[model samples]
Target: MNEVANPGSSAVVLIGTAEYDHADVERVPSVSANLDDLYDALLDPGIWGVPAENITVLRDERDPASVYDAIRAAARSTRDDGLFLVYYAGHGFPYDDDLVLGLREVDPQFPDEKGLRYPKIRQATQLAIALRRVVILDCCFAGRAGREVLDAGDAVKQIAGRAEISAEETYLLVAVGPNELAKAPLNDRHTAFTSALLHVLTTGSETADPVLSIRTVAEKVIRRVVAAGHRRPEFRAANAAVDAPLVRNARLRPHDLTGVVLEATADVTDPELRGAVILVLRHNDSGALGVRLNRDFGPLPAALDGWRDHVSLPDRLFDGGPVAQDGFISLVRLREHEERPIRFTEVTGLLGSLPLSDAQQSARDRIADLRIFRGYLGWRPGALERLVTHGRLRITDTNPFHAAFARAPFTRTGS
Candidate 1:
């Protein structure tokens, strides 16, 4: 995922169980899907800001202590900056005035000690070196996690239902009320609650609000679930210095785009798009198009290695875009040899599109930088210019060869 513009140190711990080895715990068919969706959402380059490498996922953990240990270590690891978030989607129950996350091996009769208490989580959140600590619990009767955050002394005996805990910088979201059941309805692929969460995170709707915070997320989720006639979602925030921003809305910039010669500006938020330089093959009022310069999509197929015989650069494919993913095309950087066929359009000095026939002919001369692209990016008439006007793209002249593979398309202004 793309790091926040000024994203501080961050860590994510995700735990979910779809089945339990113990017969006492009924399998929660949707927990696995919940984890899958959440993992992707947090890694969304345009939204959650949590990097894939910085995340830890425990799926159907057989060891009861491992999740807690990992969480403890993660809390310790995040010690004073960025955000630390823990997400749990599985079986859990209220215990001794607190909610305890259930282990996969949990024995119903001995369930009391088969998990960790919410107080332990609160303690970890407090001690975590991060600026913000977020706990998301998606399980039956799981709302106590929020209530206990505000008033730990109260023995939360029933569906602790969502507590309206006040906080300076509060962040906690629970799935159902104390007596309520979090349903993974047979008709749906994901639990109603988790599906609601995903919708708020990935929706394309425009919002004047700049920041997507826990408060805002809770509100959106509540609206979605209540409208569906499911149990209401709950949220509680303790004292906080500011309402933490989870993601910044994608905005466009106002600038002219020459297509090939332009850089993505501050307003672009297309995942790994901003600051990426692209090789523009076509551009005009009718439309504009290009492929990323720096995307090295692993090594090229063995047959294509012959095309790279002349250049010392690595032979790899570049992911052009998300459009035509099933098809493949080659962007050849030829040596402009006399023996080379003139059937392709030159994109830059020595670089152009290479036909499959010539590409397979074993060029009589060496090729410099030959790249295979899975797809290409395109824009409709006047759309490319509109993007620039809204700041989605920036214009700049750069050495097509070096910029395409060696450096950041543009120097970043912030994290």
Candidate 2:
């Protein structure tokens, strides 16, 4: 399950330098817009709803010490379970192998001395008591922060072992790789990466979970950035923090049961579907596809006898639905720590569908769970939504594994 950071206790610091003093470094007028749009996105009720009081915005800051002070205060103020977020959009001055944040007074000739060094930002974040921390960089060579901050196993740097800055709770979203430059078109309203991020936050993603995880947002942002022929962005998060909820999804509502469990309502008169437990394999604007979990379709077909022994509990072909009864759909859960295998379309988490032929003999040891279903339920684009809205099907939070393996029984219940 994805945990939502407590908005009231969380803190956000957004710093943007739209104007610079150095003659060599160009000013980014769009940076001011970036801060505004992100501030609005963070406060959107449908998104995170973080209180305005908890957020601080600094534009064209003249003093690097003030920036450090803001980060320090926010980090110290956030509670243990809250999230601490810091965002910087401006000129990134490369100092040796480290990246520095350019302020209004930054001197390109002496970047390390005039700019806010990465180590200062690291030290402030390391002092935070918050359980989860996020740092977003939208400047040239932003990815260098990843090498400096996220490589927790760095032997030379003993500070990387700090608890607050550990890999388990820290996440980095950089606009470009260490060698690439972030795009800031003069006429554009925001930098390329920030524009993509704001768009995803406001519009939300149809394929993501009900709550928007940072990882999901990063995936969409990276795709958009790459599609526009801009520098590719990078995302780094370790452990469960990868799936932590950054905000409520603006697109997928609770009634949209894509990759979710659905049980028939008790009052349903359809004998074939009543008391049915189903796992929706796919739901989109086109339609929905689901497989019945509890209904028994007798033993495995003779042609698929080879899979009978490898299937999970309740090893039998299931009466998936009325559509294409001759066809088969196989769901497999890959073992923990295993990378997604080829020829698999992930449904949710580690659960995914595998072609019968592909799973016949390969990577058998990596299979943690498996289920085979005959046929599947189908609904036109709006049909399933109407059914859900009218209470014919009850959306459930049941773990997908239970439905995949038929580990639990669904009773004829209320909507």
Candidate 3:
């Protein structure tokens, strides 16, 4: 799960061209409303709730440098833990195998020279301090733009000498496939993709998850766009960012914390909890149960040493938390299509916990990953939520296993 970005520290830039000056380029009047409605959706408290002052909107702008400068300024201003989002709805075309955004005065035949090349936006995003970055494209050849922006294969040539941002932390959500044209019906108030997206963000989904995550929103919008006779949208996020929450769910109560990870904030001073990385095992009205992931408690006990081959990282038992220090919890990640092996109780996705009573019956071949911990972390009914609300324990919507290992793939300042 990926955590929602902190509103105060994040920035958003929206660019759209409703009326083109070039004779050969077609006008998309709906692009105007696309910007307006998206602005409202992003600012709504019930939705993502980004501050109005943090968003910059440029409509029918003739200067391409203004677009480039806005994105660069936003990226530079965002904090390391913040999120930066850039959205564009305009005419896009292929230029020398790259995507270019058409501005108000763009020449259809000379887009490479007259329009704004997407590499500039990508370069700006690549220099951001924000760990989570989003690019939403609503135009022709959007998929192509998304692909180039997310792909790191050409980062050296694109950025020249600047440090490259990790592609794993960036997300791309496009309105159409690489070969398809985005639908901007003259009869509709907004483009087909933007219309479906706005509907989901405003109405919320009926899914069990408490928050309307970025991936979930895309899934819901894709169905609507396809059903409405438009090209299918493409969403690409490779890491824990896939579960980043964008808004509160309007139709449901806050759900369980089975899949959530909670990282202690920088201000936390508790010796046992400060800088702790905890993975929630259960959560409900009663309380919450989790395990600390950053400590090791040496090798497994002699009686359970048989499973040592399957343990993750240092091949030792983890120091879960202060509670029930003698108890042991075994977690396993099942293979792609394997059935639920004996004693396995799923926590989320492919991860689950299994009792160690029958080692032989556990079916070793079905296991794709494993972790063992001693003790557990427990919190009273409302205590955990209060801590999170007060900023003591930051909620990170991410895969639990990422923090389970000794060293994670991405940089986690809190841990």
Candidate 4:
């Protein structure tokens, strides 16, 4: 069983709300919707290539106390090895040298509410002092959220070179540069900075590396934002390494590995029996390399539709191997016998059987769930081994986690 990994040390918090009851501007669905999208992106196991248990998400309509509690829990859970990510997306206003993140109840008449207090950048910096922190602020006037402006001579010292003595683990990325205002386009669902940020994350670039350096990602985001008709995004580091990587998971490039590939026609050949990630399989060729990934089980048998009251089977049937397209492939997970004659996919590790309806029903009852994919991914003979040897494919020693299928991918931080 591939169980999801727990958030041992890394934590993520996201806050997005546009319903400022006191403000003149009406609320927009995009604000909350974008935040939800961001939350999904961060929690995606495939995005970080780690288990989903390592992340947590908090959304709009949540009370400040609950929000703070979640943050506190994450902070306490990973005292020393903590990697914290905080994201805010909504209205922002300048307050002295810092900026304020407007809460839903904040009104223009009384923008500052004691109950919904603005978390100062300095406070965030202080929190960062105790952990590795990444902060993303997406709103108008966000650049002023940090320390006070310094004289030109002092600017370099205050913002750039002063690396010693201060909190050395915090980094910030704001939507716009200092004194620049962020624009919220009518047509675009997300702010320009945020849209660009998402594009860069999903786009597979040749120069992309696994370390996920903050500077690199920021630069790419800024460039993309400017190209998309927006001001450059602002980046700030507080006594931290500029090149420090962002993601805990190793970064993956495009040309890393070739997934599984099998012929549409059935053939019992050894050449068809290879791949680290199986793309396709025929049951006749490989005698049902059990528990295949990336193939959907067709419709369930009519007799067993409601017969098994407590168990759930896959909606679609699938060819467990590349050799038998029409034949049925079954997955069996039994409690009585721990060991069985089955080839596990390792990604999901359920045992496989060749067209055994009874065993299939039993397995369906035992696992009680299924994932159906249109096609599978596979590699030819020696292809996977060569990729691993050449450093193109990195095989993590950590085991696969089950939480990946629970939901789509999520982003740890948002623009």
lDDT of every model, 2 decimals: 0.65, 0.78, 0.76, 0.49
**Candidate 2, 137-205: lDDT as tens digits:** 999988888574443233224444545534447778899988788999779999989999998988887
lDDT at position 16, candidate 2: 95
What does candidate 3 score on TM? Answer: 0.57
Best by TM-score: 1
Q: Please provide the root mean square deviation of candidate 4 (C-alpha atoms, Å).
A: 15.2
- Per-residue CA lDDT of model 4 for 1-415, tens digit only, reads 0111122456666777667565484565566666766665554433333124545555444355555666566555544444667777777766554566666765545454511234643453344323566678788777776644232234446656555544345667889855777766776687677776665555524453544566566777878888877887787766433335554222353232222232222222233332222332322212222223433345655654653463345554442444445444443333334443343333234422323444444434444443333223244433343233323334443222232123323221110
Error of 3 at 369 (Å): 62
Model 1 CA deviation exceeding 4 Å by range: 1-8, 79-81, 148-168, 248-415
Tens digit of per-residue lDDT, candidate 1, span 1-415: 1223223367888888788778768888888888888887766544544656778898887665666778888877774547788888888776665577777777656665666567776776666677677788888888767664542212132214435533324478888876677878885878888899888887723666645766567788878888888898677656433456665443322222432556777778876566566677776556677776655555667865564456544445667766676666666666655555467666665667776456445552545555667677777755565454335666666666665546233232211
Arranged by lDDT with the best first, the candidates are: 2, 3, 1, 4
Which segments of model 2 are wrong by more than 4 Å?
148-168, 238-242, 253-415
Q: Which wins on lDDT, candidate 2 or candidate 3?
A: 2
TM-score for each model = 0.61, 0.57, 0.57, 0.56
Residue 298 local lDDT, model 1: 56
Tell how far residue 134 is off in model 1, in angstroms: 1.0
Model 3 agreement with the true structure over 261-356: per-residue lDDT tens digits: 889898788766877888888887798888887776776577766655654324457778788987888777778887887677888877878776
